[model samples]
Target: MTLRILILLGALSAFGPLAIDLYLPAFPALAQAFGTDIEHVQLTLAAYFVGLAIGQLIYGPLIDRFGRRGPLLIGVVLFSLSSLACALVPDLDWMVAARFIQALGGCVGMVAARTVVRDLCDPTTTAKVFSQLVLVMGVAPILAPVLGGVLLAAFGWPSMFIVLALFGSVCGLAVWRWLPETYPADMPRRPLGGALANYGRLLRDSSFVGNALAGGFAMGGMFAYIAGSPFVYIELYEVSTQHYAWLFGLNAAGFILLAQVNAALMRLRGPQFWLMRWVWVHFASGMALLAVALAQPAALWPLLLPLFCSIASLGCIMPNATACALARHGANAGSASALLGSLQFSIAAVTSAMVGALHDGSSVPLAGVIAVCALLALALTVWTASRD
Candidate 1:
């Protein structure tokens, strides 16, 4: 892919992270605005996760049958409209619903971006391409919260959604004017009824199942961090919202840095090799985080070290796991990418809800959840390696 195409696809893939991170700094403000608790505010994030999980499944078949560009453009339109709705919502319940709708629309970019990579790149190059995409997409996590905090200070929380709406519109225009339909017109289309059977086949493929779940569980841990960090930083550590973004961005920078390293190292190591190695790193970091959280240390640095490591490990883990899973599914790239995304978001939704439900004004819940997820991912990675 050309640099222009790669950047555009990366931006498309970033839609989810941008939406999730941009309003994180406003969680406290949102709770105050709606006369609710942080738990209720967290429901908005969970709702978005749920919408992402369901929408990927729906879009997978549509993209496979119809084509990538059309479904993608339509989804962006829906996302832009839903973002506008989120900006105008009268209450928390309405906000939650709007966020869900926005996810339903925004998730199309994720499914299409991965499928496009599968269409254009071979397995050897897939991991590198994904890492490169991460280099571009990673900018969202690093910048979204900082921008959100600024918007919150200047124009209040609703402006974040307005900005997201405009972003979606720009993405739509980019797709319409520049993105070519990567899905081959000559490739035979599967009957919509067969999507389930296709999914079943993928599930039964041990390599695919193992890698997908390994990656899914790792992603789950990241979502746990995302869902819990605002409370941990702002409330427990007493960091201001603006400063919180810098901390969040620091972790993202680590993630991006490691991803670029993985891409460069790909010439010497296979994706599974890196994936297997990093899951261990992630598990170790997660355990340390849990231990520190259990100790209830007075200082934040003790917790931050392991937290950053665990989050950063995913930089190597995700692209490798995804490339490995999709390597053999070229003909069914759309469906495969969809199922992979769906499973990841489903686990993310669960982890997000878990963090909210288990909130007790402490860091242990988040730390514990990340630890468990890392353990599960480790097990799945081992299983995937055994299959190889």
Candidate 2:
């Protein structure tokens, strides 16, 4: 892929992360403003994940039928409008609703970006391309929370939504002006019924299913971190909001850096080779995290270290596993990408909700859930490795 194309695709894929991470520092403020608890505000994040999970399924077939650009344009427009709605919401309920709508719009970019990669690149190159895209995508998480902290301290939480709206608008214009429709209109389009069948076929494919599950469970661990970190760092550790933002950014930086390392290692190793190694790393780090949390350590650094290591492992797993899954389905790249994304986000939504539901003023719930996700991912990896 050209640098220009990589940048554009990366930006498109980064929308979801930007939306999630940029407002994280404002969670306490949002709860206070709405006269609700932090957990209620957390439902907005869960709602966004739910929207992403379902919206991709809808867009997958539409993109295949209509081609990529049209659905992408519409999704960005919807995302922009919903972001505005979020900024203007009258209450927490409206905020949650608006976030769901925002996710519906934002997810089109994700599905379309992956489909376009499949359309343009061969399988070997796809893994490299995805790693490069992850590098580009990594910028949002690295900067978002810090920017959010500054904005939250100076302007307030609603300003974050305004920034998100502006981001969507800019990305929409970029897609319109630059992103070519990779899916040709003349391509054979699956009928709606056939599309559902396509999903069934994918599910039954042991390789695809295993890779998807492995990636999904790893992503679930990340979502658990996202959902529970604010409480763990700020409420439990008694960190300031500014410090919390930096801490969040620190973990994101580790993730980005390791992704670059994965890209480098991919030159010498197969994607699956690296994926297996990282899955083990993730499992080990997660176990260590659980050990620390269970012991009730007096200092926060013990927990933070393993937590950072676990999240960083995702930098290796996500791009490689996604490339592996999509590599198996060239003829139906859109559907394949959709199923992969939907499964990943669906897992994320469940993990996030579980974290919230299991919140008990302790770090054990988050650590326990993260450990389980990592273990499940490792099992999936081992099961699939033999097949490969």
Which prediction has the highest TM-score against the true structure?
1
lDDT against the true structure, per candidate, is 0.95, 0.91
True lDDT of residue 8, candidate 1: 94
Residues 1-388, model 1: lDDT tens digits: 9998999999999999999999999999999999998888999999999999999999998888888988899999999999999989999999999999999999999999999999999886999999999999999999999999999999999999999999999999999999998887779976788899999999999999899999999999999999999999999999999999999999999999999998997999789889999999999999999999999988788999999999999999999999999999999999999999999999999999999899888999999999999999999999879878
Q: What is the per-residue lDDT of model 2 for residues 25-94, given as tens digits with 9 covering 90 to 100?
A: 8999999999998888899999999999999999988888888899999999999999989999999999
Clashes of 2: 0
Poorest stretch of ten by lDDT in candidate 2:
184-193
**On a 0 to 1 TM-score scale, where does candidate 2 land against the true structure?**
0.98
Off by over 4 Å in 1: none
